[model samples]
Target: MGYGFAWHPVLLNSLLLLAAALLFNRLAGRRYPHSQPAAPAPTPSERVGVSRADLHAALAERGEVVDISEDDLEDILQRAEERSHQRRFGALRCADFMVSEVLSVSAAASSDKALALLRDHRFDALPVTSSDGRLLGEISLRELLAAAGMHPAPLVGQLMDTCPHTSRPDDPIERLIHPFADRGVAHSMVVDGEGRLLGLVAQGDLIAALFREQLERPA
Candidate 1:
């Protein structure tokens, strides 16, 4: 009986070890499966077709174009997006559009002289500057005439606006949009870092520039 009991204990231990070995082998096979790693998900290709799709998606998001065909709209959006990127990076500065040959008059100049400058250039307003080219203010024909009607003095200083809007030559053209909208402002003076007159930006110039950009874009 003692021999039989000892044999039973030995058999039970051997069975337990066998079970553990089988379980470990099953787990290892699952972890390091025989199959090869899934062919890396096919990488997307870059092509003009993808670009066209992106362009269409952008136009659809705008929700403003209902009359144009898909092809035409894609072309327009692509060109517009290029220009937008240029403007965003400050490629077009105020100096690029400003008229550097500004026709201005001295604040000390007589109202008659100022009017003559305006008449010669057919300008509605002229920047009034010190003899040293420092911008003092702005004078308009309407203000000149109004001043003449109200007082005898014909000096431009008396007729000029003391607080005229000013901008820098390096400024982005977009900076003028709000000012242009708030006032029916047709022009703004471009000044140097020292507040000296550098050039002028007219609404007509901006409009012309936009037209030119559109024309020059790739069709």
Candidate 2:
């Protein structure tokens, strides 16, 4: 009877330990999933082995490709060919598209005075210059508005974009397109041989020229 009693306690203890171990294993697994092995890192050589079908699959996973029919493609190409024929490469000049008259403010002009000009003309930006028409800088409407609330006379020289990018009049139409396309500048100053302001080339000028080429195409 004593041996049987001792054996009963030992068996019960063994059962309790087994139950506790199972519970611990379940809890540990749920709490620390990251303790498992990490996913494999991609190899650089993988890209070299990537096929065109794989590339298509990856892009497709991101978004669906918009399909255009063969007929549509042909029509677009026909229109493009016609525009190429219509472009008057020799006749086009900088003076034809440039805005000759521009409202340029002196570098010494106060922010308040500049604000007044913008209010009257509804212009968002103005070019800053010296009295001699020497280009100094450019200021935007947003900068002017911010200064207006402060009631301060910020000098145009201090606020204007001094190192403004520019282009030459004698340059080809590609000059205008490249800047607008690459740098996101809305307008470019057409400078003379001596860096004098000859005219202004805007996004509109390029658009008009491109459209004119298309419209004047031989039917």
> For every model shown, what is its TM-score relative to the native structure?
0.57, 0.56
Clash pairs, candidate 2, are: none
- Backbone clashes counted, model 1: 0
Across residues 1-219, which tens digit of lDDT does each residue of candidate 2 receive? 678876688888988887787788788775422367785553332233333345557657969664765456544544553344335443455566788788888888888888789889987777776776766777888788777766567877777787766777656554455456545678877767766666677888978976886687677
lDDT of each: 0.75, 0.68
Pick the lDDT winner: 1
- lDDT for model 1 comes to 0.75
